[model samples]
Target: MAERKLNGGLKAALEYGPILAFFIGYLQLKDQVISIAGTDYSGFLVVTALFIPLMVLTTGLLWALTGSLSRMQLATVVLVVVFGGLSVWLQDERFFKMKPTMIYLLFAGVLGFGLMRGQSYLRSVMGETLPMRDEGWMILTKRIALFFLALAITNEVIWRSLSTDAWVNFKTFGLTAAMFAFFLSQGRLLQTYGIEKDKV
Candidate 1:
């Protein structure tokens, strides 16, 4: 049988599903651990230890079910295993927190380098689905790279300064809302560059 094509909604769900699952699982498990182990148990610490590997497993299952794993997904899995193992072995949450930072910095550096070379990596990723003029793609790439950088900084601040509950809330709802807003704001550009079915 031929593989089914995933629409934007499906793609978004698959991409965010594991993260959402982790958030939910962490909250539930944290409560359970605290309740079972008494007040002495560090719920946050316990959840942090369990979250990464759970997320990685969830993501892998999602990929297998969908039969799709993009380069970004592959990179994410690799990071999860490496950093997650370090987190468990070292008994520290710092490595897990740094994962997003590393991803953002890597993307920023690569995109910045691509821009310098007159290439738009973002365009390469989304070009087929959202065809646009060269200038439009370049603009989109720059904007996206900057957005990722902002998200990275935000994650760092939240993880460092906020309570675990707050960080979890931000990761689940705040970050998702921000991304949704960003996507909606790009509607005008997408419309401008959108190809009609007749044209396609």
Candidate 2:
């Protein structure tokens, strides 16, 4: 799970491509609803369909190139396929919308479980990329676990209270922005914890 930095563009593409694919596919297919069993489907179905294959392809390529994929990436893809397939096949938008919540909650559970076992899953993955003291890793892990839970709650709120398109936008763009901002806000803690940005 220790990954050196990939090329910036490739990193962004690998990370964001599936989300963008969903958003774009939804937009392009908004009017092209596919009918099944005399029922017409809409953007959600198209988005889920596109998102799954794109995620699988991207993650598989990453694993092929790196010879490894983290537990998180594997779980994310699995959830995407499971929930997304349910959404598409069962014609239930809730399944698609719950994907992120499930992913975030899963991560939170993992990180929490790791912490309870006196280990840091984040550190296990990022040890090479972002060296830090054990204490730092512990604190960061707790923070991230909390953040993941918060994100899950937020996703639930947004999906339930807002429109599908709005939720899609949040998934594609808003989440990325929020994560970047949170990362930026952690600069001081990272610096204190022996972050070697220059070397990295």
CA lDDT of each prediction against the hidden true structure:
0.73, 0.86
Model 1 residue runs over 4 Å out of place are: 1-3, 7-13, 31-50, 62-67, 197-200
User: Considering summed lDDT, which 10 consecutive residues are worst modelled in model 1?
Assistant: 33-42
Clashing pairs in 2: none
Alpha carbon RMSD to native, model 1? 3.6
Candidate 2 structure, TM-score to reference = 0.90
Model 2 clashing-pair count = 0
Q: What is the lDDT of residue 153 in candidate 1?
A: 94
Q: Give the TM-score of candidate 1.
A: 0.80
Candidate 1 per-residue C-alpha lDDT over 74-149 given as tens digits, one digit per residue, 9 for 90 to 100: 7777787777667656757677767777777777778888999999988777777787877878887888888888
TM-score of each: 0.80, 0.90
